[model samples]
Target: MKIAFYGSSLVSSYWNGAATYYRGLLRDLAARGHDVTFYEPDAFDRQQHRDIEPPDWARSVVYPATEEGLARVLAEARHADAVVKASGVGVFDTELLEGVIRNGASHAIRIFWDVDAAATLDEMRGQPDHPLRATLKQLDLVFTYGGGDPVVEAYRGFGARRCVPIYNALDPATHHPVAPEPRFSADLSFLGNRLPDREARVEEFFLRPAASLPDRSFLIGGNGWQWKELPANVRHLGHVGTAEHNAFNCTPLAVLNVARDSMADIGFSPATRVFEAAGAAACLITDAWEGIELFLKPDEEVLVARDGQDVAEHLRALTPARANEIGEAALARVLAEHTYTLRGAQVDAILAEEVGQMRSVA
Candidate 1:
């Protein structure tokens, strides 16, 4: 299959989960013999901030990140077997969105691959910008990264023919645990880019706990957090790249998983970090999320902590040996159910079924 992905910047994946998701998925696709071309705007200073490059597996094309960029994408998309318009490209205009909607109908099965379903829906509900409503009504398929149930329902209610959840999965080779390093090794660590909505949760779940457990070294990694207050025992390591993520996860006695607003609320919608932590065989201490038991068995595969005190207890009571046991169990569970291999297979099956139905109609 020849697939063309029109998405936000893939060059700099520093604070971009969507790009990371695309990279992992496309790499898997390319490995399976599919020719994949990822298109991104040249804006966002992607050339200067690039964290990843084409790795013999797939091709990458950088456009202007403007309406003009979409024209180039559409021209290239004319040749693709399928074209995906992922949400959060951050450079969309009505001309581009509708061009794919109305004009590029022949070879392009324009898909709405939403990386952040909840956030995107929030945008759609309030402002009605980007001419997305019109584009969505014409979308061949809509794919969501998170938003377990409510998101799918919303998409359909909003007039999509099909809505499928393509949940995040761990690329095992990149995220597994490693030998300890003094610099990154800590009692507990949390890594995520800070956003305003999540800042309060971070304060409650991470900072307070670190303050209480002064003896335990707590570490935080990510960008957009320059303003956040930190306790004395907590270490702030800015923007951890994909390569450093494993070292960051493995070096910790336990890694913490913090979900953004919607995933926490919607339940069962685990982020890629959840699987990354598990793949590292790191026992996880996660904030209370709706459907956590579906991924890691509470108190067995992972420990849940809501308030500051709960986090302290987990840190105090969970010995390194116990942590190792929990980590192993979590890894086992995820390896059996949530690797990218499984996700790719699921994607293939879904696309095949959808394509078959389309062919029948044609």
Candidate 2:
């Protein structure tokens, strides 16, 4: 099957958190003998800050952020067996969503692949005129990064034909244990872009804990945090590249996972960083969210933190030996169960079944 994925930049993780998820899943899909082409807009300075070149596993098309550029890519993508319009493309998303369905091949499975389902669903509910609401039922299927039953049911209520949560998973080839880098070393570290939905939680889970333990070193990675006030002990490293993720995860005594406001409330939406950190066998301390056990068992495989206090206590009590033990446990669990190899197979089966059914009906 030929798959055309319209998403944020695939070669750049700069300001684009979905880059790793796209690479891991699409690479897996390509490995399964499917032709995969990724079409991303050259917006938000992403092309200028690409972390990796166009990969051999998948064809990458970086289009200009203009209507003409979008049209050219849409013309090329119309023939794919599966055409995916991912959420948060950051440029002409509405046009792309509607365009794919309008212009794609008659038998093509038009999919709305959402990296942030919780947030998207909230928008749909709050604004009846939301662009996706108009196309919700027209899409052949909706695939989410993660949101579990709540997201599934909500999309169904909104008249989606089918909705599946293709939860985030680790690509061991991309994210695994590496020799710790001195710059990322810290008692506790967090890497996430400072966004409105996530900043409050980051402050509560990461900054507060850093303040509570002034003597302990804290590291903050990811872009847009350079201006934010941080504790004297916390070192801010803006924009950690994808190639350095393993080292970033490995160097810290513990890595923190803070969910966005919507993701935590909706539950079951684990960010890609969770898997990346765990894949590196980093002792992960994550904020409380439902369905975490489905990915990594708390206490043994991961450390669950209810609030800033919990994070502080976990950091204070964590021994190097205990951290390594938990990290190893996480690594074992993800390698065995939560990996892109498994996720890609699952999606491949879903697409095959859906496409088969559509063709039969035709």
- lDDT (Cα atoms) of all candidates against the true structure: 0.79, 0.94
* 182-213: candidate 1 lDDT, tens digit per residue: 88988989999898767878888888889888
Over the stretch 1-362, how does candidate 2's per-residue lDDT look in tens digits? Answer: 99989998899998899999999999999999999999999899999899999999999999989989999999986789889999999999999998899888888999999999999999998998999999988998999999999999999999899999999999999999999989888999999999999999999999999898889999999888998988899999999899999999999899999999999999999899999999999999999999999999999999999999999999999999999999999999999999999999999999989978987898
C-alpha TM-score for every candidate:
0.94, 0.99
What lDDT is obtained when candidate 2 is compared to the true structure? 0.94
Residue pairs whose backbone atoms clash in candidate 1 = 177-280
Give the local distance difference test score of model 1: 0.79
Q: Score residue 359 of candidate 2 by CA lDDT.
A: 71
Candidate 2's displacement at residue 236, Å, is 0.4
Candidate 1 accuracy as TM-score? 0.94
lDDT of 1 at 23: 70
- Against the true structure, candidate 2 reaches a TM-score of 0.99
